[model samples]
Structures are given as structure tokens and as C-alpha cells.
Target: MIKHSIRVTPNRKGIWFIVNRGRIWLSAKRELPQGTYNELILSAEPEQFCLIGQLGDQDAYLLVNHDHIANEDEWVTPRELLTVSEETFQLAARAVQVALFLQTHRFCGQCGSAMSLVSWELAALCNKCGHRCYPRIAPCVLVGIVKDNQILLARSNRHRAGFFSILAGFVESGETLEQAAVREVKEEVGIDIANLRYVGSQPWPFPHSLMTGFIADYVAGDIVCQPHEIEEAYWFSFDQLPETPLEQTLSGQIIAQLKQISGNKKAT
Candidate 1:
């Protein structure tokens, strides 16, 4: 059962780091400690990653990168990000996720008091008041709306100019994740869906969000993209599916399953 799923790597201690200008670097091999990374102390543990900011950035927490790095630039030299594995992104994302929460919760929502990290737990303690704060991740439902023989997808203004993604929205109060899934499809693409099926989920910590994926049958209505949210939307035939964007994620997984199921039905 677990053989096909993504596995996360554990963070170990005693790893030497290279702090070039500002960013930190992790070596490729466990024993190879090359470059200026050896000079800096292990400020946080292996799982903890740093949130870079200006002076007096009290809200910043740490994030750890164990995966092989993917992107490395001179100015934002992400040594760890460059050398980590694909599976490690989940761990790194989790670290940054906590930091992202801390960053946003540094100030008290109740009394505007500055919050400090709690040593015992993953929370912050307010200085002026007794309020304890923690990070938050807004829940969102991303769905693939399918009809007779096609799936509905749209180009988002939220992403890069030409990138298209599944219809999605933040889960509103009093609504279950499933309800949100149906509502989001209606609000974004002006379509109703049935046979709501859970696909999978991803930890999208670009600030913080738990993206729940679903595959729903398009019941009716024309593809009317909501303004400010969706720019263009259309149903593409399964055999003639549009060029899917890069990155294998929850959305990608949903598409893969859809293709498999659709194909099996045709054969039978």
C-alpha cells in the first residue's frame, strides 16, 4: 500500500552549513563539508528552515530543507533548495509552513501585542497579554469538473500569465470540504457538479494552504468563468486533453486517475 506513495526524509543533526552572503547551503553528501557553509553554526535543526527578513523581524521562524535542491541562484543562493529531493519538498514546505504561520501571527489579533515563540510547543506567546497564538492554513478545494466526455479547467489570473489550473477556492465557514468543492465550481465556472469523489491532497505552503482535490461530474450550465478569478474555461475531450502544465501534484494525480478510469470504461 505504501510502496507507491511519496516518502519523506528524516532530518539529522551535526550537518555543517554554508552561509554565503545570507542564504545557507547544505552539502550533497552527508560527510562532505565543503565551501563556507562550515563557518556558520547550525542555528536550527535539520528540519528547521530559515525565514529571511530584515532586522526586527520577530515573527520569522525556521524551515528545514532535506530534499536535494532544485533551484539555485546567485542572489538568492538556495543551497538547500537546490540539493534536496522531490519528496523532501514536503518536509521543507512543512518547515516554511510553520514559519509562515509564525510570521503572520507575530502580533496579537486580540490586543496587538507582540508574540514570542513558545519553547515547549509550536506556538507563540503574547508579550503584553496571556494570549497564545499559532499558525494557520486556509483550507481550499480544488476540483476537476467533468461532464459527458470532457473535464473543465481554467486559466487563472492568480498564476503566471498563461498557466492554467483546476478550479479552486477557499473553504467558507459552515461548509464541509465537499460542500466547498461544489460551491467553488459553481462560483468560479458557473457549473454544477455531481458524483463528488475525493482524489488526494497537497500541502501548498506558499504562505499556507491545504489543497483538497476532487473529481466531480459536470451536471449542467455553460462555461462562464467568474471575473477576477477565472479568465478562460472550456471542456476538452479526454483523447484531446490540453497540454497540462509541469509538476506532478494532487491536480496531476487527479488527471491521471481520470484518464485511467475513462480508458477502462471505454474498453469494457
Candidate 2:
């Protein structure tokens, strides 16, 4: 239900945004009011901009391509921006999502024509052609594989320390979400999974992704980490699970759920 639910912070905070010939420019909310109008970003920013309503709240995130953060390292973990509220983080994440969508879809794929923002609705329309492009959410699956009392998880080469997660991959061209989950497990760690059951999903707007969650039982196979993709793979007993990264994300939720289920089974 988290996908259907987003937190609305408080009020409107000015976000200074710019688009040069339709490319987003980033600037702080304070600096944006004084700059030329193009595209704008209106989201939650306690120190920079005011906290605003949640995304899908009938308020469009005015997206301007401006990088105004004091520290470049701070941009990686977006939840640290301004106020620390779920709603605020959700809004900010969606803002990044919208900006990324617009940036990538600026040009029409079919005819290679320039695209313009639609007057009504959050979509881009081809200036020369009549093509309408909407925001894209790449469908992916995250699975928790459990066998006996231990659970299977992997650490990606891209993740920070202490950040391990369930096996995940993008839904392929002609595969179902469940199929993708199974295939990802095999490809990432050479493991076979069974009893794939849907748990929940999250709108990971960090560059626009919808992560579908599943819990699968480990059938067979050894811990063989995929090269370049997964740095390490391991089986952690119920009593020895590693620390899970919790940034209000789907991966975090699945880890928590896995631990809870394992604990209950041990208790009974």
C-alpha cells in the first residue's frame, strides 16, 4: 500500500528551476525566484524551500535543472534533504523522478523530434510530431530467498557498506514479474527459487523504478556471485542476519519482512 500512499509534508516551498532550450537547470529555491522562468521544481526543502504536499497530490513538481546543494556527496542520499519526513522524502524522490523522466524524454524516439511539456497532464508532447510521452517506471522485482533457517542475499558492487539486499533484476522483454525474479536469482547468484509469492511493491522514483517484491524459497544451487553485478553472496541464518539498509525503500522493507517471518517460524 506504500505505493498508493505518499506523505504530504506541510506547505508550498519555492523551488528554483530552469530549463535551457528545454534542458533542466538546478538552483536553490531562493535563487530560482530571481532567475528566468523555464521549468521549476516545487518540492519539500525545510532549509532551502518550504515543505510541500506529496506527489500525486495534484501539485506538479516544478523541475528546473539546477544543482544547488552545498555538498555533492549529499545528493546521493536524498532523504537527508531539509525536513526528515516520509512525505518529504517521497516528494523529493518523485521530483528527481520527474526531472529524470523529462530529461530523458526531451526528444521523440519515433521521429527524433523535440518534445514539449503538455499543457495539461504530466507528459511531453512532440513539437513537430504528435507523439505524447509519459513518465516511465521500469518494472523490477526484488526477491527474498529462504532455505531452512537461513536467507539468501547479495551485496551489489554499487551499494555502500552494510547494504545488502535480496536478489533483484529488471523485467525482461517477454517475461512476467515472477519469471524475472526467478531469472534474476539464477543469473545473479546461480540459485534456483521456488514458491514465488508476491508480497508488496514500492515506487522507487529514484530515476523512476517500480520495484515489485516477492518471497521465494530456495530450491538448490551454490552461492556463486555474478561477476561485476554482485560483489558477494551469502546465506545468513535467522540469528545472524546482517544489518539492512533502511531508507524507506523496497529492499529495506523486504529484509525486514524476511527477518520477521524467519523469527516467527523459529518461535513456533
Best by TM-score: 2
Model 1: per-residue Cα lDDT over 1-268, one tens digit each: 0011112234322222333223434444432232233343344434333332211212222334344243344212222342354444444445455545544676888899887666545677887878987667788888887776677778878666555667888999898999999888888888888899888887765447888889988788887889987888888777977666444566767777777788888899
What is the C-alpha local distance difference test score of candidate 2? 0.64
Mark the regions of model 1 whose C-alpha exceeds 4 Å error after superposition.
Answer: 1-86, 160-162
Output the TM-score of candidate 1: 0.71
lDDT of 1: 0.60
TM-scores for the candidates: 0.71, 0.74
| Per-residue lDDT value at 142 in model 1 | 80
| Residue 74, candidate 2: alpha-carbon lDDT | 23
Best by lDDT: 2
C-alpha lDDT (0 to 100) for residue 80 of candidate 2: 44
